[model samples]
Target: MPSLVRAASIVAGAALLLLAPVARAAPAAGGYAALGDSYSSGVGAGGYLADSGDCKRSANAYPSLWHLAHAATEFAFAACSGATTAQVRDRQLSVLNAGTTLVTISVGGNDIGFSDAIETCVLGTDEDCTDAVAKATTYTRDRLPADLDATYAQIHHRAPNARLVVLGYPRLFELGGCFPGLSEAKRRVLDRAADFLADTTAGRAGANRAEFADVRGHFAGHGVCASDEWIHGVTLPLDESYHPTRTGHAKGYLPALTGVAP
Candidate 1:
């Protein structure tokens, strides 16, 4: 199965390179620069990038997907795996200039250790998961927004005319009866965390004069444990458990682009 997957990936990579034209040398005008972490990188998604050293930076990532669809004149894709809000401001934002026209970001998950919280809580006993959720919720409510505010401020300062769009985290758990392995209490915890992330991102975007892409609704019933899930759960056949599938990236990029484009 692994070998077959590799073979398929090779074929897809070849096709993308062959089909993707070296976009008419991007004009000097400002275009788009995407910033964030693994979610924005589209780690498990396929087709979009010329294989670079950053293994996590997939071509199916929202930025690349949007870029291909729109053929944005200039694109600076600085999003990396495991990036926090601080990294978005410090490392990714530095690439922007006055000419940068559009900006999209998906961050803060790493800030409050969101993934780790899910791993520990979602798979644990109900009471344990609830406690984890409480702790995570507190952290997310207090710190996550502040970090995002700083990131948005930096982007606005560097590229005032840039239209910024913040992508909310996708729902990582389904409602009742989705994943049998997930206890009701555990599912509730995951649901709350996802909601908190969405609210925080939306609020921050509004505070920063930016737009918010509500991804949670689009991913409903297709989270970690859904039979036709887009997000990988802590289960078999999904080596990376907790990332989006190729189709997931394709689905996510469309809405994200719509939110950012003028």
Candidate 2:
């Protein structure tokens, strides 16, 4: 009797299990294409893909990281080092298409002379920094709008179905920390220029009906001068200087991309 009762209980449990509700399936992963310059390529984040060569697309970059997180069916990492807006429009747009359901870009900095401004500011006199900042500022405010318009239009046309997300630059410094490293004056102008660039990029993103991922807030208190720095301060191998560190991509860029892309 005990053996029979145990068998009956087991059968009843199995029947209940079979009748339990099934969980719904997850949403289909979209085709994601990462495009633009070194920021998107992850220049400073390290762990470079050897085939990427001079472009230095880091495994740790936000796009690569995002791709890993989503495990998307297709991912085209097309961003390159030193890529200007025209360069992106020419070289990288090929990966985008109607099939591509997600796209993210971090451009306009090169077009507005961010690297040049930083170079002059870090290596040149105060006057030089001011002049470089002034030139980049002028172009960013006046001419960059049209350049961005063209690029955004091309991207939208290429991936009409994709969710287009534009990631903006972060302020590279916190006021007093870099003190002796860069004059407070120089840091001020550089950060100011970064804000201008962000505003310009955000404006264009809105105009083109795309989402803008603003990373400045995430990078706040984590610039070069901060104790917990996400940006490098005049490091070796020239190209890495002033670029986001690995933590920057993970904590800064990644979250920004998530907020807008999702």
Candidate 3:
């Protein structure tokens, strides 16, 4: 009887030791809040998230996939279908709280309506796209840094302790003649625009002490016009043209999310 009692005591102590960490590892106070637009929501990608009404957010989006892979305790996805920087501050920032452990965002594409410009000008004369690309590039270069700063400040204010990761947009066009549908001139214009967005976002994130995910490098030759494309081409198989395919989402976004757990 004495031996049995001693053994039982030892078993109980071991159980407590094992369970302590599990109990303590519950989701942080406010959980993880993901903010951004269609790209972050995985619009064209099919598996990141359950398709929701407001954002059309997919279950396979990187953020959602990150949460699942890590078994994140709490998740608040506020990314909308067509959110801009202003929308992030106005609508989503408030949801963040001090206990939040992780926050990821991808914005700025909709600010100047780059997708519209691509669809309109890239499909038209090469000269037209070149002109539009130049104008759009100028606008993004001038205004994007300030907008990024404000967005970062707002997110920090709301979730002071959370590790913020700002994802740069992926390359939308190939460097050379990869996209047969789009003229070589138009492809150059699109590639330049994509490069501008990536550089701006990375620069801003560095200044703000947030992690910058340079997703463009991951899909070097897989832009809109590439034969083995990650992003959808100008003439999408379906109606949606700007979003990425599931493979693109996995490649373009998942690498940036590695080890991003709360």
Across 145-175, the per-residue lDDT of candidate 1 in tens digits comes to 8888888999899888888888887877676
Candidate with top TM-score is 2
Clashing pairs in 2: none
Error of 3 at 213 (Å): 0.5
Best by lDDT: 2
Of 2 and 3, the candidate ranking higher by TM-score: 2
List all candidate RMSDs to the true structure.
7.8, 20.0, 18.4
* lDDT of all predictions: 0.69, 0.81, 0.70
Report the lDDT tens digits of candidate 2 across residue range 1-262.
1256544433333222112111111122339988888888887899998778777888999998998988745888888877778888877888777888998999887778766676566566789999999999999989999999999999889888988999999998899845547788899998999898999899989989899999999999999889999987655454677789999999999999999875
TM-score of each: 0.82, 0.86, 0.82
TM-score of 1: 0.82
Model 3, residue 219: distance off in Å is: 1.0
